[model samples]
Target: MDEQTATEAMDNFTAIWNTYTLEGEVVHWLACSLYAACRKGSTPTVGKGLMEGNCVSLTRILRSSKLSLIQFFSKMRKWADMSNLSQDFRLRMDRLERNFEVSTVIFRKFEPIFMDMFQNPQGAEPPRQPRSRKHRRLPCHISDVFKFCWTLFVYTKGLPPLYRADGHVSSDEPPPCVLERLCELHDGLVVEAKGIKQHYFKPYIQKLFQKQILKGHEELLTEMLDPQNFIDNNKAINREYEEYVLTVGDFDERVFLGADADEEIGTPRKIIQEMTTSQTAAQSQLQQHVEKSGSLAPSTPLTGRVYLKEKDLLVTPVSSATQSVGRLQSMVAGLRTAPSDHLMQIFKSCSRDPTESILARVKTLGQTFKEHYTNDSDDTPGAHIEILYYKILENVIVQETKRLHGRDMSVLLEQDIFHCSLMACCLEVVLFSY
Candidate 1:
């Protein structure tokens, strides 16, 4: 292979191989190919015969080709043993590589921010003024080694656990491991809010309410119950987070879009607004009321507001949205770790195929694997084949979630379309159970 080809192959190989446990057969093939290439003092001509070499021979060949065979082998060994390398070492290796490894990709992501900082040194966010480090890059410091190490740590540690003994994920799991961290964050927020309430309101309220003129805590009540205060405090954070999610979704679309696709597509915000309006309109029609004469009144419609206020409720809108997200995240977490007994029940309740069932799918998947992939089969239950189908199911869940912008547009609908789309593929008619 030429320099370009070699670099490309290594990039593709390291991108996955660095993170995953490669099968023995795959490792042998890679080893043999590297060995043969080393023997020839150039890129090895990979073929069936060259891919079945001994591990020792393969290691020698890799050393001959890359000159960093020791480190590479160490990484491979850790992967085989299902262990992790030092975060610092991993970051160093990733950056030293002349290809797009995870560290390099992260650095590239921060490029725009770096350029902005360089242009206007006095900006509001001047690249966070990297913490003073001992070993900075030459000539005013190109990069921070510690920062890179931390970034690598975050990417690997924060990344969702992709491998299980079964080598599979479930239908209802979140895409990134970030979701779990987000859950932790949600809990932290709740704790903080509770602290704020206890510290600021509890003591002050007792004294304020004790005043006879106030009459039964009404003086302190207005300070707490006013909807305007909730909006005023949380509006900025809510707007910023909403904008960030929209931007991320847009980025995902841009990455996935075909080259021929138009660049001027409608923004997610516009699409979501339109959908929300339509859903609100539909809900209004359902809640429409008639006067005592039994004739429908033109002005009487169901609660058409995005948020309905209860007479005695006490929660900020942002707090409610946060709780909703936490619930959704928990639902995902439950689906991941639950056993077959509970798993089957969850799927049965959600799927359109109440009879065929996830249990049925599990069994059918086994048969299909035995029939077509018998030689490749392992002793594990619903191994690789079943996992592949489960991944597809998970992807469908993501699509449906995105379609509704993480809100149940059909929450107003009597039937559970969101549930059906995420879990039920076979049901022809989903009855609204509002």
Candidate 2:
């Protein structure tokens, strides 16, 4: 390096010596770091004020994208969920931005659908939707749309990258979320759930309140989680979080998907022990892998950073089938045993193999469709949703025929069916709840 350049660099380093510590190009941003503390109630580590600093407005940063709320936040939500932020925040995300324009537009389109999903409108047609977006109330509560998105975001940790203001998805897919099944369980439980105490949720919550789970709060929980008193969780916010050297705790999954605790509620002890052993084995393997490479490569300087953007989304349609089956099984959990297995068989039968002749495929599935249309009652799981699916599929088929250029999903189906197996795939996926 030039002597002049070296002298200038040394002078600059000397000026900011209090702000950062450097030892042979290593930087410790002691007080001048830009990384702001987010998640609202996070406590400081390394004495107080370590992470306390001036903040940049993430909302302002996002506004530069000029995208709708769903589009802008959808990808970020997915990344955050993948990072297990839900486990940290416990579904308390920042409030929705004041984009009533986009939220109201989607709500308006789905108002009639939500209203009549439960009850069949007694007329030749459903109620006419209001033309004005400014109306405070409509046929269905506008908050229902927000509620749907909120529930979906909390459970699944994401929403679809919706492009349209009228609540249409970019793909010819069914509704992005299968919320009916979840709602069914909640509604059923709510009838019996007079209050938090009535559900006996505290016992299950108590098991998770271990120091290994919440960390450092072992003593605090003794007093905090006493029975006959409301657990003041707000006071729990001041506790700092700690991480191990190499791996995320295997209990991370427990925190993310509390299904294990839910399942063990009334389960046999032998089964729970066996499941616990299996989980321990799996986690040991994961811990070994994590130790080898760690969370980042060359973990010396800790310079690795990540930014969430629209590019990270995977656009496959398999998620539809997965959620549908989950929703169907959940909705029917009280009514039937082995609903998931039965639903899977039905879905497999409805969607034929890709290599099969279109005529043979359609003819066999067409027969199945006729049976469904004739036999299924409107009160059944996904009965109304099935109609909505087929109706959308019909519209998709029409649009494909008239479009100048179309994309190919399957070669054989595209040759014979013109629009390809999107229609067939849609049926298979939508049939999850059906």
lDDT for 98 (candidate 1)? 29
lDDT of 2: 0.35
TM per candidate comes to 0.17, 0.17
- Each model's lDDT comes to 0.36, 0.35
Q: Which lDDT tens digits does candidate 2 get at residues 1-434? A: 23443354344435445443232211211111111123222334555553321222332223333322333334434434433345443332233323323333333443344443443222224245578867532233233232332222222211122311333223443333334543464343433432322223323233335423322244233333232121123123211111210011111111111223223122211211123567989888778867998753445665454543565676556876666667755543444211134333322343353333533544455557657656555454334333333344445544543441333323323355542354455456556544
Per-residue accuracy of model 1 over 96-144 as CA lDDT, tens digit each: 3322234334443334443333332222331334478663322212233
Clashes of 1: 5
Off by over 4 Å in 1: 1-346, 349-355, 375-377, 380-382, 405-434
Clashing pairs in 1: 352-424, 414-432, 414-433, 414-434, 415-432
